[model samples]
Target: MIVKTSRPAARLAALVLPLAALAGMGTAAQADDWTPTSAIEFIAPANPGGGWDTLVRTTSRVIQEEGLADQNFAAINVPGGGGAVAWAQIARDTGNPHKLFATSPPIILVPLAGTSQYDHTNFTPIARLITDYSIVLVPRDSEYQDLNDLFDAIRENASLSVGGGSAPGSMDHISIAGVASAAGLEAADVNYIAFSGGGEAMTNLMGGHVEAVITGAGEAAGQLGPDSEVRALGVSAPERLGGPLADIPTYQEQGIDYTFDIWRGVMGTPDMPEEAVAYYEELFAQMLETDGWADARDQLGWIDAYQNSEEFGAFLDEQKEEFSEVLSELGLIR
Candidate 1:
């Protein structure tokens, strides 16, 4: 290697070396980028027409219309154990990024009630999308004009059962419990019947199996009209919502000190890669900004409450603490 190269030849060689280095960098960038290679299984941990099912279907439709992701989103229903069945299934698929399930307070409430083996800690929080209110419903022919009237009857007649779409001590159970307790009835004494979904609860109410039902307001939309069979006794909202729900009274307006929000979000399997979480976080953020989501929110009566994955995780922690205190006071957190 004694021969010395000319200055021009040396410069050309140096330029070629830099070009090869740039190509290698490009390859690494491509390798780092992650996206779903197949259709995604968007699980709705509940029966069809339930809140979770509606959320998944609506979200997938809007995302598709907006061209948010290349892969298709298929909504799968797995109803049981107040979301325990879906939680167990997702838990089994550890580290899977393709699987995502719609979540509400049940994600925390179910496990707190000893119905689920896993809690929010067992999954990857993707994004908190919206907040829906809980509504107290009664037969249009029922004499219960308000929360007080309903709770009074429940107190007078111990056999009266207030049914809900969640398991006992879960979302719907705790909702009516909080209000009934506030109305001078023992929270533990409030008779709450469990149904598989809101639709089934509504059916039983018509069949006279239960006196009343509480579910996400969005889930009761179709049953809240002049021609419908159900009447809204009160809603768990600080103020009355707009649109078809505007006429419905709030617990506060009726002189009860109670409010509950059904926070809906999405979660992935345990140990999902940070890359997948990041991708979904961004995708949802963008989806919320689109006109399609706005329209759907208004129609569904969902309030805008978007939180990214990290923020959502922290929010869940706060919710766990607050709910622990509430459920403990109600004697349900055993």
Candidate 2:
């Protein structure tokens, strides 16, 4: 099971900061010691229209519209090896502060799974922006009524399988494992099947290949309407999400003690200058207060989870250790 940790003070303060304070919080960044002189290359280490790409495009537009930065932020897509290709490029460009990229849990998971040579330690953390959650789904006509019922059924029938988008021991595996363990099932005993992506996982669910599907909340949003083919059993969010996800109850609300955070953030090349890091950190803290960012976050089903560099780096270390524990339980630790 995943051990939950407390949020950093910086993250807590970021959530309650008033608009006026947020506006002036970046006064320290006005120094000429470090600031982007040219257009900042904002990279999404995935194909266009994916989560990271959308975040990059949306962040660029909001920053440009809000007049947050002096230099324009240019969105770039560098897709390959599920982010390894772009990560390699960033690793080679040490100290390049102008090039920033969108990041999420895979920064840690991929490396621990032995897919990527470089990990979060190879990059300079800028700030964590928002957090998304995972959801458990079953076919609309399935007999299971909720997460507990499903776990009970799995217990009675050991052959049942839960499918997910990520490879075994990745986000999907860990998400399902976390809840299964919380539900009184052994993490290693749960039958998990991996698919290419969430779409495929959902498709297989509809086809009756898998007993259920567990995926990111936003990833499976569209198929979760009143008349949709799939219904949510429970969400891995601490609280219920907004919009289409608002109706879905969280695991805690359902008497299960579990929550999985799919945090999204920004990071720079390795050894990024401290001054440059400060500039971006302050810039993102300001972005969290923008009306555009607020709207984008709402539409994306994300929660405010801003964490400055120091807080983010510490959080990453904690997350790595936590994930390592869960991965070990599943015997897939690399």
Candidate 3:
């Protein structure tokens, strides 16, 4: 689930100051001191075709297209255990400056759910690149017309099942649970069925086997169009997105007073050199400034929410604590 907590502007500036200094935005010597000496390994902890895979591949493509990096980027898939397998490998490569991976809410959620031994604290945070929100959908002919309609029905009928792409207590489930709680429903009591992926969940919804499905807004976009079988009830974004998704209203717009964003970023092996972290921070900052990255982000329905290493690290800690409370509330803490 995506939650946006307000950080004071002064606090945010303080968090960013060290990263700006390391990037040589306020200095010069540091940026010249660090550059990858060989091909960089970009790891996607999930199988190809999933969100992590898309992020790693798209970032590599954008960097190469924009000439943002001098070294070749090798996108590697290390799929397993909801990122646990890759995190284990990364832990074994501590201090390896040439290795980095795509990261998101799962990095925090899965571990807290006791499915993994490694968490965000095991890695050196590089930067947070983009944010995406969850989309709640139902079959085109379903009776639920909006988020309230769906939640009201679920509340009235405890047996009604909701489905999501992630594991029971992970991203997709947590997303809807958050909204359910905000809508005055008992989040822990909501029947959530887990699917292997959003595609599978969507299939079940289209087949009339599930009451509703929650998945990434980008993933939902692929199935929603002029002649689609799924109808989006509400998105977790605070505001409406552009392009084909502009017509979909946010939960806030529908008076739900809820928001969630799935943040994706890059992080390195533990004990990675400060210089390497600084190098990636500067490289990603440059990448975000390029037209190539902007175009890629827009096409993928990603919102730009860049945060340097220090800032991203702080954000991860806050998320860990926030999610702990949420999971505990939902009785999913392991």
Candidate 2's TM-score reads 0.77
Q: Please provide, for model 3 over 116-219, each residue's C-alpha lDDT reduced to its tens digit, 9 standing for 90 to 100.
A: 88899999999999998898899888998999998888878889999876666788878889998888888886899976556567778888788999887865
Off by over 4 Å in 2: 1-34, 37-39, 47-50, 70-72, 77-82, 139-143, 152-161, 195-211, 219-223, 227-229
How accurate locally, in lDDT, is each candidate? 0.91, 0.84, 0.86
Candidate achieving the largest TM-score: 1
**What TM-score fits each model?**
0.91, 0.77, 0.82
Better of 1 and 3 by TM-score: 1
Task: Tell me the TM-score of model 3.
Answer: 0.82
Q: Model 1: per-residue lDDT, tens digit, 136-237? A: 999999999988888888878899999998888899999989988887899977889998878788889999999988899987876678899889999999
Model 1: what TM-score? 0.91
Runs off by more than 4 Å, candidate 1:
1-32
